[model samples]
Target: MGDGDRRLTVNGSLRSVPANPPRSLLDVLRYDLGLTGTKYGCGEGRCGACTVLLDGVPVNACQIPVDEVGDRSITTVEGLASRGELNAVQQAFAELGAFQCGFCTPGMIVRATALLRDDPSPSETEIRAALNGNLCRCCGYPRIVRAVERASEIGRSGGGRP
Candidate 1:
């Protein structure tokens, strides 16, 4: 590897790429690695559109550099599903029509995934706090909250195979 190059694991695969001085992990994932589920909403990390799981914690991809990722496991929205089946949170989101524009769905889903893993039965307030960063212009908070609640139930019921 070159001096400015780093290798990182993303979505169960190891990939090595140049560590661009100014480019963020969002650029690396979308441009270098072809993973575009993590969107670019504000580019300032406030919108949560670029959210991704780095070592199971949610972080804004646009605020992180490729070299900084190191060996941590990165989970994007693309990694949420297994065997072409949507995860519990995703299924709940769809079933509840939690998204209208769908621009914030990926980040919301990613953040919710971590939330459920930490607290399978989070209260609505807890769910709101977890998804505070992700913004949906369509004003879908009520349904989104319901979706997360549903996902928690699904998790306990062994349904949706999430």
Candidate 2:
């Protein structure tokens, strides 16, 4: 096997690509696997538009090296839905109009999913803290917060599942 040939498992699919060793996970995900749901708002890690779950933890895809991902399970917005059913957070976002431009919706939903998984009932402050890394330029944070809260309530009441 050549040095450039690397194996990456993304969104439950395994793929082999001729990627440079230093290539970021964002590049591999977008260019190689065609998972464009993860956006590239800022090359740096400040913006969470490029966020994806590496082993269920939100991380900046632009800052993660493909080679370093190894056997970790990567989950992007594409994986949030299953069999034509949207996840709870996604449905909440859609119902509440949590996003304006939709550029940051994927990352926000991903982070909110993680938050809900960790805390079934999170206070507004806890939700804000959980989503601190993700930024929305459209200034839709209030609705986003409301969406997360609603999702939590729906989840607890067993109404979040599709």
lDDT of each candidate versus the true structure: 0.90, 0.89
Q: What is the TM-score of each candidate against the true structure?
A: 0.93, 0.94
lDDT of 2 at 17: 80
- Residue range 46-160, candidate 2, lDDT tens digits: 9899999999999999999887898899999999888888888998998998999999999999999989988899999999999999999998999999999999987888976
Best by lDDT: 1
Query: Under the 3 Å rule for N, CA and C atoms, how many clashes does model 2 have?
Result: 0
TM-score of 2: 0.94
Q: In model 2, what is the error at residue 141, expressed in angstroms?
A: 0.6
In model 1, which range of ten residues has the least summed lDDT?
A: 14-23
**Residue 20, candidate 2: alpha-carbon lDDT:** 69
Estimate the lDDT of model 2: 0.89
Instruction: Please report how far candidate 2 places residue 98 from its true position, in Å.
Output: 0.7
Task: Give per-residue CA lDDT, model 1, range 1-162, as digits (tens).
Answer: 788778889989888888666679999999988898889899998899889999999999999977678789999999989989999999999989889889999999999999999998899999999999899988889999999999999999988644
